[model samples]
Target: MIMAYLEAKGAKNVRIVPLDADNEKLVKGDFPSLGKTVEVAIAAHGSSTGFKSLMNGKADIWASSRSVKEKEVLAAKGFSDLEDPESEHVLGIDGLAIVVNPRNNVTQLSKEQLGLIYSGQVSNWSELGGPDMTISLFARDENSGTWDSFKNMVLGKQFQLSGSAQRFESSENLVRNVLQNEGGIGFIGMAFVGKSKLLAISDGPAQAFKPSQLTVATEDYALSRRLFFYTHGQPSNEYVTEFMRFAQGINGQSIVRNEGFISQNVESMDASLADDMPADYVEMVKGAKRLSVNFRFQEGSAQLDNKALKDIQRLAFYMREQMPNSKLLLIGFGDKRKNEHRSKLLSKLRAMAVKRELSRLGIYPQKTTGYGDFNPVASFEGASKIKNRRVEVWLR
Candidate 1:
């Protein structure tokens, strides 16, 4: 779904292909649309396999819906060999599912019940008040990306499947069989639940409910899954990077929701000046274009007061997640041109202070520079210079 979303965003040359880190005989691009062109290879496997392909250099974009694990990070022996090895990007979330046959009336199942179901201890449908027949089970294939994810989450080292359970090649295939067969249930990505009857699994009434963009957004849905699309460090091509930027934009998420997953609600504000940015002005600047705007700060200081911090934090969060490439120029000013020269070094220190705080919060590899008080509001010279003795963050 995420790969499809990117294609909808004018990423004309985008392609989704299967990949294998250890073997390529069955790992070739077998999907029909992928054969349309081999312009660039993007291996959108389940998260683990996607990372594997990324580390192996077989793919440009590694598509999956989970955060990279330490185990997987250790698996990146080859990714560090990239020209620029630190390139990593996180896109959006996909709500995971515990699907069952439409005929099954069980609207919600607790986490304990789910553990039992997967463990094979709860084998009969009648145990959960459905049919008298034994509950047939299925999972993704051994080499499947989803299978790797499930193993890490539910099964782990101690996990095992019963003899009666069956496995399929893909989630799409699994959903097809689960829908047609009675008393059969399976777990799948939420996007696949479209057109098929799905049961809502919940932990409690006040918060528990069916999975949707809304439920998942509010964290009311227990099965919300984080979807991801990774790249090997950062791509060397501008188009590949541009396509990634498009994927994180509103259009990509719109496609994600339209394709049957949940949509992300992006926060926005109309700025009167350089106001309404996240508390980290320098970080927020990275996400902003070269739009001219005004910002008011404390009367005599560059320090961010409590009230100003609130607005900046909101803007900064969105910027960091959405714009990974842009850098912010954190220029500080003094009361006058005379003060500017002497304040230049001090201003530089102030900008570095902001960068340090943001980097501590995990916004890495951003640059910051300071220019002393040369630019000020002409209308309010005295009062504004006091305000001008402030940090003016802008996009470069």
Candidate 2:
């Protein structure tokens, strides 16, 4: 969608050659800015196919809804580390919304309950305090990145999607089916929530949150995920590199928001502090607003992940433009640890890490602290627990 928008904006006499009845394989035109004919070939098969193409030298950019897998990184050893911040580009954010028929009264669910429902352990709506009707499941096909995210984030290793569930290749089709069945429940990207009802989802002890631009952008929403464009090392093709720059720039991010995905544009919103929030944490945030960007680390390590590296620059730019004189605060949180002091130290270190990065970009924060394990967004039991290790930005 972003590519098509860019082509329309900058290209003249654009031509699209169909790969099939539904997908276009080649888009070519004379782009005025580049002063040359540019042709881009896209294969919209699936995320896995993109990685496969990348490994074989058939694709310069692997556009994906999910992060590249470790196996894929190993298979593409010929290229630079696929997991490096240079090669892994986070293009946008998306929230995987759990949807149900609008008529259904259930408005929220915990992640464990969701796993149970999808795995057929709790097969009736009444089990969840809804109507007595038997639940019907709908899901994306296994090949879909959406399915992969849902499986990893929601189902984890303990549960498998029930065999009775109906699967569809298209989110719209799945949504349409869900809309027709009052007992139906399914998950789709936030953009596809459409007429179907969306459920506020909670992970671990975090309060249930509805998918919104703010929540998803902050990654406080339980199901939020990043959309990516992976290149082999730093892209050598000037056109490919240029296109990526455009995609991550203001005009491209605007297109992202318009297309119903969350752009990485930094914005501030009133903090929705939970009642269970620690007294000191609440006191610190008083009269302050939280930025939409969250700086998260690579699992168990204080090093900023690929997305956080990009966010450091975004946050710095935002500070200059929107809140140059505002009082800035950085608070970090970490997963539970056996040693409380170690947890606090590690969390503080994470915040300091973010502060150092911002300082280099000429944005100095006023105060930095760590809440340790006071608030967790996911259970410590699974890989998703990495969400707990993060630094949040706030402005007064």
Candidate 3:
């Protein structure tokens, strides 16, 4: 896309050489739209090789899935300081999805349980509420950035993957293998989750989260990580700088969206109950301060998602230590489901669900109300309708 856009702006003889460390071949097929003006040759190795290529002046750009490590930054001091300003650019965000065969009945797993499974401490499906069978493990090779990120996130950097686990050179192969085995479990980039069942993950049994653009952008998904493009210092070349800017700009972000990753430009926020709410709800929270967090539900369900579960812990602590005598107003909003009455009722039910969760945390709401289809963050038919179905917290 970037190449095409540049061609549209009338640049000539453009070429992009991308060295991929993930071992997957990058086939830069013909782009008739761009009139074949740009050439992209992708070399498969590991992220380390990309960095090596950059330092040795063999490649112009290092497309890395993971951030440049400290040791790597030191190695490229002569030619590039990857950490320097304008040298590193974030292209997109990807949610590392935990996938299983469609036949697997397990819909959720806690982070600790995931750690144990990958570490070889839990090898039986029965231990995790699955049918009695030996669990099959698939993983990315150690050379890949996906493997490094998974190890750092789930298994500590000091821990090694189970010896029994089968490792693949690419995410595509790992996902394919998992799909074929009923008891198979693995992790892959969200883009590779075709026809595979994605598991909702939680820190505990209380709440679980599935990866979505909203969730991943807000980092509600535990495994959400940023994708990067590293250049040698700040590129002084006109074509390189323009390409980098194009990738970081709105058009480039559109490409990121098209590629099945969360665009860096995607908006994510914990909006207060104060804005554009009903007059009554606004009055109720007139003198109150809004917490930096809000509650959200799973799609089509009244249950809180994993991020809300963690937010509850922080809110509880704040209430106990900072505002012992304060009162809370729980205001819920719903999308247009049916008629006005049904929308209103559904909204109330959502608020009540939040109240129940607060009760579990030993905190009680002084008042609660639901405003259905009232103030929407986006159009009802737009992709962001889910943002409207929420409960906001206000302290008085």
Candidate 4:
């Protein structure tokens, strides 16, 4: 898309700049060229970092395998508050291809295995291999957004860097390294596959096949990601804006398809997909608070009523996600009117109702306790209110 557009306009000296932090830093001593209408340089940096390069005037344009970040947008808006910034565009769609060398006959790996490998657990080729060799893992530098997506989606969470691994400065280098190594696995922008053999993960959510143009378009690619180039807004430069239109328009999309990544156009997700998730991720519907519940039983009866049981069931579901790992305390509120012996038993039943209901729902509480007619939240002339006569979920 870039080459064709530059040629059509008769623009000269256009180069695809691989804008990166180091590359940006290199231009600190650059002196303005004597006379040149256009100059393009290629940098091998991630998308957000590329955006930074453009904003800081490190390059005429930057290429990336990711999209503008939320923070980058705020930064662009901030820069826009100052002077004019270059125009932005969405380059062709690109995804990170989770690849293993052709020598690797593992056939497929579940998301879990993929996570384990990258997290440095299953470190040997023999662990899931044909040869008794160490599994050579390659990864991109932290500066790359492609690296971020892989770490987030594949690793699930971050920890101290794995003690054994190889890091490359460029995505191009990472892809090449993976292709050249046996029993080695790594990720690179799908565009950089070249002659490397790609493997498929069967029954994957994205698809049940290998990484291919068909898989990407048909929604079978597991490692699909978006490619983006961000700018403050449309630039004041006619040349830059015109290039942006071509890059953001249909032409750029064609390049994206040729590059081997799936476009969000054929992408199956929403923008707010992350919002439906929790801050810690993993969709733990449980929340933390400090509310109390009271369960009261009849003077002589140790049986729980329908209302109490219903509330217990609710608390069970609400707490189910946290069960087995989280603890629950069941406190029974006893009625002020109680017989000496029955008082203990009545309060005990109320507590039992809650614990049993939770158990029935497969929500395990670590322990159950009974507090007979004790620790009343509210009392009218020492009388218990039915509203206070129930099991409550206490979130910690």
Highest lDDT among the candidates is held by which one? 2
Per-candidate Cα lDDT values, in order, are 0.55, 0.87, 0.73, 0.53
List, residue by residue over 257-348, the lDDT tens digit for candidate 2.
Answer: 98899999888988677778888888889999988888998875678898888888888888898788897899999888999998998889
TM-score of 3: 0.63
Whole-model alpha-carbon lDDT for candidate 2: 0.87
Q: How many residue pairs clash in each candidate?
A: 15, 0, 2, 12
Candidate 4's TM-score reads 0.54
Candidate 1 regions exceeding 4 Å error are 1-38, 42-45, 77-86, 156-159, 203-207, 267-396
Top model by TM-score, which number? 2
The candidate, 2 or 3, that scores higher on lDDT is 2
Off by over 4 Å in 4: 12-37, 59-62, 80-89, 129-131, 158-161, 202-207, 218-220, 256-396
> Per-residue lDDT for 37-72 in model 3, tens only?
445445656677778878887777788778789899
Model 1 over residues 1-396: C-alpha lDDT tens digits? 335544554345454444564222221222344444324443333566666666766777777665566566666645542212234443554556778877777777754466578789998878987778777787876655566555554554544666677887678878888888877788777777745566666432222356655445423345555565666666787767877766655676566667776544333322232343335543555455431211224444555433224324433565577655655555554444455466777666666656655566665434555555443322123221343444544553
Per-candidate RMSD, Å:
15.8, 2.1, 14.6, 20.1
| lDDT of candidate 4 over 228-329, digit per residue (tens) | 455555566677777776764445555655555543222111111223333432222234332322333432355554223333543554465343355565
Write the number of the candidate with greater lDDT, choosing between 1 and 4.
1
Error at 158, model 4, angstroms? 5.8
The residue pairs that clash in candidate 3, if any, are 21-46, 21-47
TM-score of each: 0.56, 0.94, 0.63, 0.54
